[model samples]
Target chain A: MHVFYQPDNKKHFLETDEAHHCIKVLRARPGDELVVTDGRGGVSKGTIVSINPKRVEYQVRDFYQVPLPDYRIHMAICPTRKAERNEWMVEKMTELGVHKIQFVISEHTHRETMKRVLNPERLIRVALSAMKQSQQFHLPEFAYFLNLDTYLGQVEAKERYIAYVASEDIPRHLIQQLSPVRPVEILIGPEGDFSTAEIEAAQAADFKPVSLGDTRLRTETAAVVACHSAVLAQIQ
Target chain B: MHVFYQPDNKKHFLETDEAHHCIKVLRARPGDELVVTDGRGGVSKGTIVSINPKRVEYQVRDFYQVPLPDYRIHMAICPTRKAERNEWMVEKMTELGVHKIQFVISEHTHRETMKRVLNPERLIRVALSAMKQSQQFHLPEFAYFLNLDTYLGQVEAKERYIAYVASEDIPRHLIQQLSPVRPVEILIGPEGDFSTAEIEAAQAADFKPVSLGDTRLRTETAAVVACHSAVLAQIQ
Candidate 1:
């Protein structure tokens, strides 16, 4: 069954874009059944009651609640030089069940790249698509921080980590440092990585320095891996 | 320092494409230093002796052997419908330190997609770029299997898994089933998962059915997660 995102569970209609996608793109007609998620763990089965290019009305047939993950994962990552990589990270992180994503502007993130201004609407569309593709009920919230310090000052989680590449001697791994019971957050820097001061500041904020694994990963890859590690740590 | 892939560490010169990149793109001068990898375990530091667009000659200053991972990972995955997604998978898998990738055609893989063969050379380039990007001395080999059975019959590993999504009740996860001391192989299907017969055949071949995690992941994401799980499992 096709899944639609309609944040208002009480409403019998989908938003304009989603409605257009249903009526025009998918050719969804009256009486067609579909699933709708409020993106807050509420899922409902609905039958299309009326459909138009601008509006899609549905009748709720069943309602259910999906439980949120016991642990919360918030990734504060500097967007890569490439826009698509950032978008890809958002999609995969959403699929892997991260609770929130805050795009950070780190010392090493090129100022010119930041000037491009990652469109929030585009990122939201990517996240929404991934949430639907993965059949997930919850959509991860997205935020942007002007700099790493802003993120460091604002975020709170029981377990905090910063993914930094250290010298040959291994630091503590992310999985090794993860607390399955506590809400967790990880800081992933840009391609050039965190400067010494940024790293020190994060450490001062109680964000333990951790390695994702032995291999060197790009900014986007590290974000996805860190998110998955957080998700896997909760399995037990 | 820029890293280059020269499979023959004994050679004094890099191959055509890399030579062009070093000389024409980066405009390296004589006496510049670079790191070269043989894509097995050999790593070398070299000083440029001469530079040309098509041939870059270097004098080896030091040679060292990087130890192979204690465990091996082989991923057999069906190519996603999107060609870029497949390329992205190859790049990420290589960066994550997967040993080999075998593209297989499954029962549900669209015939049209399989007809448009995945370009081996392009995939190799991606792996090589990733190996250098990740600053690793090893490159993952790529192979194509006509069908799932062909892959099942040829590959051998100590731990085998098929990443199949089952019902709501959680199944055994990949990390939980991994053996850090053993070589591992995992099969990830396309958007359309493995057929019942294919899963049965894999089971007969001693491939344990495993879940990567609770959330639904795209084929590429699942493959990367499985590879990382295998890599992480060896950490102990």
Candidate 2:
């Protein structure tokens, strides 16, 4: 079933983008059945009542709720220098299921790179499309780009880990360190990796140091691995 | 340390591309030390002896080998309709460590998509870059695209699995099904998924049906998840 996002349960109208996809793209007609989610766990089966080029209104025939997962996954990553990589990461992370995503800046993030443009709206659209594609009801919340310390200060989770390539002592693998059914957050650094001071601040903030695997993963790959590891850890 | 690929340990010259990257991109001096890998486990530290724009010759100062992982992961996937997605999958799988990657064409693969141009050379370049970037000594071998039945017949592994979305009973999750320290091969279907006949052929070939996770994943995401799961399972 093709699912559409309609964030407001009370509003029968689909948003402009969703409406365009439905009416202009899919050519959905009046009386056609539609599956819609408010993306807050509310899913409704509805029939299209009316359609304008920009407006699609539906009448709900049945409503149900998808129970939220027992554990939450929040991924904080240093946005890659390339926009496509960041977009790809967001898309995959959504498909793998994340509760929140935040872009962080560390000492190693170059000033020119910091000035690089990001289209949050585009990322949100990618996430929404991924959520629907993956049959997920909850859209991941996006946090603004933050400094590493600032982001760590407001951190709230049952467990947190920073993926770092330590020069000295080897850290435990993230898979082994993960406890089942616990809300977890993971931090993935930029191509240059997190500075020593950033790692120390994260440690002070109570984040454990964990390695994803033997290979040195790209920032995006590390994020996906962390997300999937968290999802798999929750299964048992 | 910048790493270069010199597949032939006996040959002191870097490959053309690696030479260009080293000389043109990094502008390394003649005496600068370089880390080079044969990609079959041999890693050597060398000092540049001569530099021509297209040819770089080095003297081996120290030679070492990275021991192979106890287990192997082979991923066979249906190439995504989009070339970028396929390239991305190859890059990530190499970074995450795959012994072999085979592209399969199934019944549902459209003739048009089959004719869709794929640049194998470019993909190999991506894989090489990823192997160097991830600091892995093993480069994944790529098999030519084959028919599903032909591919199924050639499979040899301690364990094999096909990620499928069944309409009936839920299959065992891949993570739970994996046995530690065993060579494993996994197959990921196209966007439309494996047809019933393809799934049956795999089952007949002793490929167990397994689910990656609850959420639906794209062809590329499923491939990465399978690759990572195999890597994680081998840790024990």
Candidate 3:
């Protein structure tokens, strides 16, 4: 049985696209056993009742509910110009586990990104694929369409930090500062780094600036490191 | 002037390609100050002596000695078919700091990689670029061209770990297991993962199996996690 994602299945039916994949690509037929997830930590083992080119109906044989992790990640990163890297970030973080992602549009964000809009659909697709790949069911929500003020306004975290390279201040490394607290948000800047003014503003906004480590990491690498650090901090 | 890599500089002259970047791209002139690194913990600041189409001659003004971290990373990873990700592994690990990389051609290693030989120069080039990008001054040695017996025969590590997923025999997370010990080697397998026989052989050879958190990470992600964990564990 192949695994597929069907986030909402109150009707217990696979959509046309997924039905097409099951029937045509996977050669699935009626009475075949299938496993699917609802991306909200709900996985079900089902037997197909009927199938057509457009849809497949199934009856749930059993369901497994996964409890959410004790901690949540609210990773806010400025979009890099290379959408692929941003997609990679989404995929990897979703695999590692995250609750939400906010695309921070900053003044120093790559000029190349300014030429085009960030695609939320593509990020969702990447997230879904990674979720399936890692055998995780939770899909981290995107907060990209929101502006900085609205995004910050919506974040209700127990801990908040902004990752940036500090000069004389010498920000503490992220791992050193983590306390395994629930609901954490960490801001990662772009290639040129967050401007001094942006850092000050974030500081005023109560974002504690932290460094991932001694090495200067790329934006995507920093995001993943921060995400993993938060996850590890909560584990033990 | 712009920074460039000249790996073999015993003759004290930049090669044609680097010279082109220096003279043509950067328009560096005689008597101009320039920074170049030998990629082996040697960073030298020099003054241009002369330039030609073939090479740019420089006299070393000063040399910066980067102390090899009190630790070393002996990362042996099964190469994935996607060479881009392998290049990415080289770049990210180099940025984060590692002493060496070994390509373990294992039984479950992707068959596609077996068809094409590992490219050491390309890996080094990516490493050099990452070194400069991260402002590091050391290049990690590669052991892909060597036979496994000869490679493992030279093991001088204080600690050894094999990163893999286990079901019955629980494995400690890599971070929880690291002790800041010097000369640690961690093996990461391919997508198919190491076989039970291979695991047993490693266990017989004194390799402790370890997990990198709860997520089922990609081969590259696992290797990077192992690399970063080793580095962070070493940092006081």
Residues B1-236, model 2: lDDT tens digits: 67899888988888678888999999988999999998888998989999987899899988998888888898998888998998999999999999999888888776468547357788888998999999888888888668999999898895999996654888878999999888899999888888898888899999998889999999999999999999988884
Q: Write the per-residue lDDT of candidate 1 for residues B1-236, one digit (tens) a residue.
A: 57888888778798688988998888899999988889887988989998766898999999999988777889999888887888898999999999989888899897578546477788889998998988888888778756888888987885788887653456688888887778888999778788889888988999888887767889988988888888888874
- At residue B221, give the lDDT of candidate 2: 94
Report the poorest 10 consecutive residues by lDDT, candidate 3 chain A.
A109-118
- Rank order by lDDT, top first? 2, 1, 3
- In terms of lDDT, the best-performing candidate is 2
Task: Give the clash count for model 3.
Answer: 0
**For model 1 chain B, the run of ten residues with the poorest summed lDDT:** B162-171
Per model, state how many residue pairs clash. 0, 0, 0
**Lowest-sum lDDT 10-residue window in model 1 chain A:** A110-119
How far does residue B12 in candidate 2 sit from its true spot (Å)?
1.4
TM-score of each: 0.95, 0.96, 0.91
- Total residue pair clashes for candidate 1: 0
Which predicted model would earn the best TM-score?
2
DockQ of 2: 0.85
lDDT of 3 at A9: 55
Pairs that collide, model 1:
none
DockQ, each predicted model? 0.79, 0.85, 0.62
